[model samples]
Target: ELEALADPMRKDVSVVRKRIDVVNKELKPLGTNVQKKEKEYKDALDAFNEKNKEKVQLINKLVELVGESERLRMKKLEELSKSVDSMQ
Candidate 1:
Protein backbone atom coordinates (compact mmCIF):
# COMPACT_ATOMS: atom_id res chain seq x y z
CA GLU A 1 0.00 0.00 0.00
CA LEU A 2 0.96 3.66 -0.16
CA GLU A 3 1.29 3.76 3.64
CA ALA A 4 3.68 0.81 3.59
CA LEU A 5 5.74 2.47 0.87
CA ALA A 6 5.76 5.85 2.64
CA ASP A 7 6.66 4.70 6.17
CA PRO A 8 6.89 0.95 6.26
CA MET A 9 7.49 0.44 10.00
CA ARG A 10 9.86 1.66 12.74
CA LYS A 11 11.24 -1.88 13.11
CA ASP A 12 12.17 -1.99 9.44
CA VAL A 13 13.77 1.42 9.64
CA SER A 14 15.61 0.40 12.79
CA VAL A 15 16.89 -2.77 11.15
CA VAL A 16 18.18 -0.80 8.14
CA ARG A 17 19.79 1.73 10.46
CA LYS A 18 21.49 -1.05 12.43
CA ARG A 19 22.79 -2.63 9.27
CA ILE A 20 24.22 0.71 8.14
CA ASP A 21 25.85 1.15 11.54
CA VAL A 22 27.38 -2.32 11.30
CA VAL A 23 28.66 -1.59 7.78
CA ASN A 24 30.24 1.68 8.93
CA LYS A 25 31.79 -0.14 11.87
CA GLU A 26 33.27 -2.78 9.53
CA LEU A 27 34.53 -0.18 7.00
CA LYS A 28 37.28 1.26 9.24
CA PRO A 29 39.26 -1.97 9.53
CA LEU A 30 38.46 -2.84 5.91
CA GLY A 31 39.99 0.45 4.81
CA THR A 32 43.31 -0.34 6.51
CA ASN A 33 43.25 -3.87 5.06
CA VAL A 34 42.68 -2.46 1.56
CA GLN A 35 45.61 -0.06 1.93
CA LYS A 36 47.92 -2.81 3.16
CA LYS A 37 46.90 -5.09 0.32
CA GLU A 38 47.39 -2.31 -2.25
CA LYS A 39 50.93 -1.62 -0.99
CA GLU A 40 51.79 -5.31 -1.11
CA TYR A 41 50.45 -5.58 -4.64
CA LYS A 42 52.49 -2.59 -5.80
CA ASP A 43 55.67 -3.97 -4.22
CA ALA A 44 55.07 -7.32 -5.86
CA LEU A 45 54.60 -5.67 -9.24
CA ASP A 46 57.85 -3.73 -8.85
CA ALA A 47 59.74 -6.87 -7.93
CA PHE A 48 58.19 -8.77 -10.78
CA ASN A 49 59.13 -6.01 -13.24
CA GLU A 50 62.73 -6.09 -12.04
CA LYS A 51 62.89 -9.86 -12.34
CA ASN A 52 61.16 -9.74 -15.70
CA LYS A 53 63.90 -7.52 -17.09
CA GLU A 54 66.47 -10.09 -16.05
CA LYS A 55 64.38 -12.83 -17.64
CA VAL A 56 64.15 -10.88 -20.89
CA GLN A 57 67.91 -10.40 -20.95
CA LEU A 58 68.48 -14.09 -20.31
CA ILE A 59 66.04 -15.00 -23.05
CA ASN A 60 67.87 -12.77 -25.52
CA LYS A 61 71.17 -14.41 -24.57
CA LEU A 62 69.63 -17.83 -24.99
CA VAL A 63 68.35 -16.88 -28.42
CA GLU A 64 71.84 -15.80 -29.44
CA LEU A 65 73.25 -19.08 -28.20
CA VAL A 66 70.65 -20.97 -30.18
CA GLY A 67 71.57 -19.07 -33.33
CA GLU A 68 75.24 -19.89 -32.80
CA SER A 69 74.33 -23.52 -32.26
CA GLU A 70 72.42 -23.57 -35.54
CA ARG A 71 75.36 -22.03 -37.34
CA LEU A 72 77.67 -24.67 -35.93
CA ARG A 73 75.28 -27.41 -36.99
CA MET A 74 75.19 -26.09 -40.56
CA LYS A 75 78.97 -25.92 -40.66
CA LYS A 76 79.26 -29.50 -39.46
CA LEU A 77 76.73 -30.67 -42.01
CA GLU A 78 78.64 -28.91 -44.76
CA GLU A 79 81.87 -30.59 -43.67
CA LEU A 80 80.14 -33.97 -43.61
CA SER A 81 78.79 -33.44 -47.13
CA LYS A 82 82.22 -32.44 -48.37
CA SER A 83 83.73 -35.60 -46.90
CA VAL A 84 81.05 -37.76 -48.52
CA ASP A 85 81.60 -36.09 -51.88
CA SER A 86 85.34 -36.69 -51.64
CA MET A 87 84.69 -40.36 -50.87
CA GLN A 88 82.37 -40.66 -53.91
Candidate 2:
Protein backbone atom coordinates (compact mmCIF):
# COMPACT_ATOMS: atom_id res chain seq x y z
CA GLU A 1 0.00 0.00 0.00
CA LEU A 2 2.85 2.38 0.75
CA GLU A 3 4.46 1.58 -2.57
CA ALA A 4 1.29 2.25 -4.43
CA LEU A 5 0.92 5.68 -2.84
CA ALA A 6 4.57 6.53 -3.47
CA ASP A 7 4.31 5.49 -7.10
CA PRO A 8 1.58 7.99 -7.80
CA MET A 9 3.46 10.76 -6.07
CA ARG A 10 6.60 10.03 -8.11
CA LYS A 11 4.61 10.18 -11.32
CA ASP A 12 3.15 13.56 -10.35
CA VAL A 13 6.59 14.93 -9.60
CA SER A 14 7.93 13.74 -12.90
CA VAL A 15 5.05 15.33 -14.79
CA VAL A 16 5.59 18.65 -13.00
CA ARG A 17 9.31 18.64 -13.78
CA LYS A 18 8.61 18.05 -17.49
CA ARG A 19 6.19 20.99 -17.58
CA ILE A 20 8.73 23.23 -15.91
CA ASP A 21 11.36 22.32 -18.47
CA VAL A 22 8.97 23.12 -21.32
CA VAL A 23 8.11 26.49 -19.82
CA ASN A 24 11.79 27.39 -19.39
CA LYS A 25 12.50 26.51 -22.99
CA GLU A 26 9.67 28.74 -24.17
CA LEU A 27 10.84 31.64 -22.00
CA LYS A 28 14.40 31.77 -23.37
CA PRO A 29 13.55 33.50 -26.64
CA LEU A 30 11.10 35.82 -24.97
CA GLY A 31 13.74 36.89 -22.49
CA THR A 32 16.18 37.65 -25.32
CA ASN A 33 13.59 39.74 -27.15
CA VAL A 34 12.86 41.73 -24.02
CA GLN A 35 16.56 42.53 -23.56
CA LYS A 36 16.85 43.66 -27.18
CA LYS A 37 13.88 45.98 -26.88
CA GLU A 38 15.24 47.46 -23.67
CA LYS A 39 18.54 48.30 -25.32
CA GLU A 40 16.79 49.98 -28.23
CA TYR A 41 14.69 52.07 -25.88
CA LYS A 42 17.76 53.19 -23.95
CA ASP A 43 19.61 54.19 -27.12
CA ALA A 44 16.67 56.23 -28.37
CA LEU A 45 16.36 58.01 -25.07
CA ASP A 46 20.04 58.98 -25.13
CA ALA A 47 19.73 60.38 -28.62
CA PHE A 48 16.73 62.43 -27.66
CA ASN A 49 18.53 63.86 -24.67
CA GLU A 50 21.53 64.80 -26.80
CA LYS A 51 19.31 66.63 -29.26
CA ASN A 52 17.66 68.53 -26.47
CA LYS A 53 21.05 69.65 -25.16
CA GLU A 54 22.00 70.98 -28.57
CA LYS A 55 18.72 72.83 -28.87
CA VAL A 56 19.23 74.47 -25.48
CA GLN A 57 22.70 75.62 -26.45
CA LEU A 58 21.36 77.15 -29.66
CA ILE A 59 18.67 79.01 -27.78
CA ASN A 60 21.20 80.48 -25.33
CA LYS A 61 23.35 81.73 -28.18
CA LEU A 62 20.31 83.35 -29.80
CA VAL A 63 19.46 85.16 -26.56
CA GLU A 64 22.98 86.55 -26.34
CA LEU A 65 22.83 87.78 -29.93
CA VAL A 66 19.51 89.54 -29.32
CA GLY A 67 20.85 91.27 -26.21
CA GLU A 68 23.89 92.47 -28.08
CA SER A 69 21.75 93.84 -30.88
CA GLU A 70 19.62 95.80 -28.44
CA ARG A 71 22.65 97.27 -26.74
CA LEU A 72 24.12 98.35 -30.08
CA ARG A 73 20.81 99.98 -31.09
CA MET A 74 20.70 101.97 -27.85
CA LYS A 75 24.25 103.18 -28.34
CA LYS A 76 23.48 104.34 -31.88
CA LEU A 77 20.35 106.19 -30.69
CA GLU A 78 22.37 108.02 -27.98
CA GLU A 79 24.91 109.17 -30.57
CA LEU A 80 22.16 110.52 -32.82
CA SER A 81 20.53 112.38 -29.91
CA LYS A 82 23.82 114.12 -29.01
CA SER A 83 24.37 115.14 -32.65
CA VAL A 84 20.86 116.63 -32.83
CA ASP A 85 21.34 118.61 -29.58
CA SER A 86 24.61 120.05 -30.84
CA MET A 87 22.89 121.51 -33.90
CA GLN A 88 20.33 123.38 -31.72
Residue 68 of model 1: what lDDT? 100
Candidate 1: misplaced stretches above 4 Å? 1-31
Clashing pairs in 2: none
User: Quick one: best TM-score, which candidate?
Assistant: 2
- What lDDT tens digits, residue by residue, belong to model 2 across residues 2-59? 8877686887888999999999999999999999999999999999999999999999
Q: Which stretches of candidate 2 lie over 4 Å from their true place?
A: 1-3
lDDT of each: 0.97, 0.97
lDDT, residue 56, model 1: 100
